[model samples]
Target: MSTVLAIAKRELKSYFATPIAAVFLVVFVVLCGVFTFQVGRLFDRGVADLAPFFNYLPWLFLILIPAVAMRLWAEERKSGTIELLMTLPVSPGEAVTGKWLAGTLFVALALVLTFPMWITVNILGDPDNGVILANYIAALALASVFLALGGCASAFTRNQVVALVLSVVGCFILLTAGMPLVLDAISGYVPTAIIDAVRSISALSHFTSIARGVLLVPDLVWVVSMVVFWLFATVAVISLKKAD
Candidate 1:
């Protein structure tokens, strides 16, 4: 546990050691503002809640999370530092978990910086704070899922660009699985059962469920399971690369 924390701390500090942290945070906050105010037209809706903001989160994360995660293991492998990392006392599982933790926390910090949106909605109207809180929780869960998937993709290749592209494509598939357009397109050719299964596994569906302020046990389970599965996959990929 201590070793894992040490790795996580080191990885987290590495983000701030460069300009990546500043650039990512600034872009994230600015995009949130644009999406919420310009694209979403929050004031036009006249709703007391942050539905507009939450609605755009998955799409925002689809791009940004991969950017953050593309370097998890890909950069180390690319720079021939994975050998040095493997020489340490840490196991692949610990390294994967630690790096994932760092990435998740970094994304969470970006989310926190968007608190002004919540404040704006409150001052404009008597929004349901409970629902807003639930949306924040759902957003964090969604970000974690993306981070894990991106990290898993990073473990598969030494090229960060390849990792980023793979992560984006993989995340996009899961995200759009529950969309009406995707479901309708497949409904005619695919079996109903398979379509239902695809929708059931959609990250967007679960995110919407929780964002609606009804955090069901099933939704929580799905989030935790996805994160765990991807983290485990990342560890396995790293192990294979280490053996090669």
Candidate 2:
């Protein structure tokens, strides 16, 4: 546990050691505002709810989360520090978990900074705070899922660009799998069981379920299980790479 915390502290500090962390925070915050106000037309809608903000959360994260996660291991390997780190007493699983925790903490901080948006809606009218809370929970869970997936992709490559692209593409496919256009095309020939399974696996569906304020136990379990699976996959990939 101590070893994991050490690595997590190191990883979190590394983000601030350069301008990468600042740029990441600024870009996401700005984009959130733009998507919520301009693209979502919050002013035009005059609704007390934050539906517009949460509606665009998944699409925004598809890019930003990968950008944050791309360098977790790719830079370490590219700069040859991975070898030094692996030489330490720490285990690969611990290392993966630490980096994932650091990324998750950053997302928590980023979302906390967006609280003004919540406050704005509260001040304007009586909104369903319970639903808003659920949306935030869903957003955080979705971010962690993407971070873990991105971490797994990063473990397979030394190039940050490739890592970023792989993470984005992988996550995009998972998202598109739940879209009506994709599912409808598959429905023509695929069996109902397979289609149901695909929809069940897509993170987007679970996100919507939680965003509706229902807090389905299955949706929470699905996100958490996927996150754990990806982290384990990252550990496995690291172990195999070490062998090679």
Candidate 3:
């Protein structure tokens, strides 16, 4: 546990050591403002809640989160630093968990920086703070899923660009799986059970449910299970690579 925390702290500090942290924070905050105010037309809705902001989060994260995850292992492998990392006293699982923890915390910080949106909605009208809180929790969970997927993708290759593309494609599939359009397209061609399974596995469905303050046990379970599965895959991939 101490080793994991130490690695996590080291990784988190590495993020700030480069311009990556600043660039990501600036781009994310700016894009959130654009999507919420300009594209989403928050004023047009005349709503007190941050529905507009939350609605665009998955799409925003689809691109940005992968960018963050691409360097988790891909860069290390590309630079031949994975050899040095492997020589450490840490197990692959501990290393994977530590890196994932750092990435998740960094994304959480990005989410926290969006608190002004919550304040803005509050100033405008009597918004349900509870719903907003739930939405934030859902967003964090969704981000963790993306980060884990990205990390798993990163473990598959030595090239950061390949990792980024794989991560984005994987995230996109999961994001759209539960959408009405996707479901309708597959409904007749696919079996009902398969269709239902796809929808159930979609990150978007669970995110939307929690974003609406419907924080059920199933939704939480899905989030935890997805994160765990992807992280587990990441650890396995790293272990295989180490053996080879």
Model 1 residue runs over 4 Å out of place are 188-190
Relative to the true structure, candidate 1 reaches a TM of: 0.95
Compose the digit string of candidate 3's lDDT tens values, residues 1-244.
9988988998899999999999999999999999999999999998788988999999999999999999999878888878888898989999999999999999999999998988998899999999999999999999999999999999999988999999999999999999897899888998999998999999898999989898899998999899999989999999988633
lDDT of 2 by residue, 1-244 (tens): 9999999999999999989889988888889999999999987898999999999999999999999899999988988889889999989999999999999999888888888899999999999999999999999999999999999999999899999999999889777788897799899798999999898889889999999999988998999899999999999999999633
* Candidate 2 wrongly placed segments (more than 4 Å): none
Best by lDDT: 3
- lDDT of each residue in 10-39, candidate 1, tens digit only: 999999998999999999999999999999
Q: List runs of model 3 lying over 4 Å from the truth.
A: none
Candidates' lDDT values, in order? 0.91, 0.92, 0.93
Model 2 clash pairs are none
Question: In what order do the candidates fall by TM-score, top score first?
Answer: 2, 3, 1
Model 3 lDDT, residue 149, Cα: 95
Model 2 CA lDDT for position 163? 96
Q: What TM-score quantifies how close candidate 2 is to the native fold?
A: 0.96
RMSD of each: 1.4, 1.3, 1.4
Candidate 2 residue-wise lDDT at 6? 96
